[model samples]
Target: MLVIGTTEAAYMLGINCQRVRQLLAERRVKGAYKDGREWKIPLYKKMVDIIPGTRGPKGRWRHRLQARPTYIHVNKHIIDSNRNRRENQPVIKVDRAKHSKYCHEVEITGPCRVVYRPHQPLCSGAVLWIEVEQSTRVITKLYG
Candidate 1:
């Protein structure tokens, strides 16, 4: 049986010399052994037998809950109001009991616009409003 040096084996296998030495050291290459400081590779039809494995450590979030917001709550309320002819009338009432279930109880200190659906009837004592005390900047990771 003929044998070849590390450099010749690396050239034939299309890999680097250090990698071939590593394969030899790990005993991954079949019929390959080390003699003194040099590695002797047996020249055969199929000599190299390096097994493939994961490159690095396993991920930590595979079976665990990832990072998420501390609080995530969404509430929606329907208003019931009467259709009366009035030139000027306050559409909103300060009745917090109707929407108490959906309220998160937060204070606002900045300018914000109130939004409501026109088709939906406003409740007799239903007040719905969302105020943002401060804007929050969120950075998200996008994966294709």
Candidate 2:
């Protein structure tokens, strides 16, 4: 008798945790018992061998599950309106040698490209740069 909880028993039996609890209530697993308030359900391999069904995953990867947030609790809403508007805007370019004529308060967006050269704003070999709001950065991860 391999004593275990309903959830563990469910995994060994290839069933569900709730179903294992049901079987325990029905006295299906001979040696199973509930000893604590919230938990303390136990089972054995012999009990699991008689149950039926399938396992979820073979521990090949990790899984993260979270409850869906209500619409009112959304963190950030990226309006697609600005994304398309940027396509029609004009591109701004200036020679690196002529950057002294430019101002820092310039509101630039859209298809602008920069030609980087020595003594220019770019410190790397990059010939182009873009300005974006520091707070608008968003990252996402998905599992399927």
Best by lDDT: 1
lDDT for every model? 0.43, 0.36
Candidate 1 local lDDT, 1-144, one digit each (tens): 878788756644545678777767777666777789878787554344444435765322112111221121222222222234322222222222112222223333345445454455344322334322222211112222
lDDT, residue 59, candidate 2: 30
Please give the lDDT score at residue 61 for candidate 2.
Answer: 13
Off by over 4 Å in 1: 46-144
Task: Name the Cα RMSD for model 1.
Answer: 24.9
The TM-scores, one per candidate, come to 0.33, 0.30
Q: Name the lDDT value of residue 41 in candidate 2.
A: 45
Q: Evaluate residue 14 in candidate 1 and report its C-alpha lDDT on the 0 to 100 scale.
A: 45
Error of 1 at 117 (Å): 80
Q: Cα deviation of 52 in candidate 2 (Å)? A: 11
Model 2 alpha-carbon drift over 4 Å, by segment: 38-144
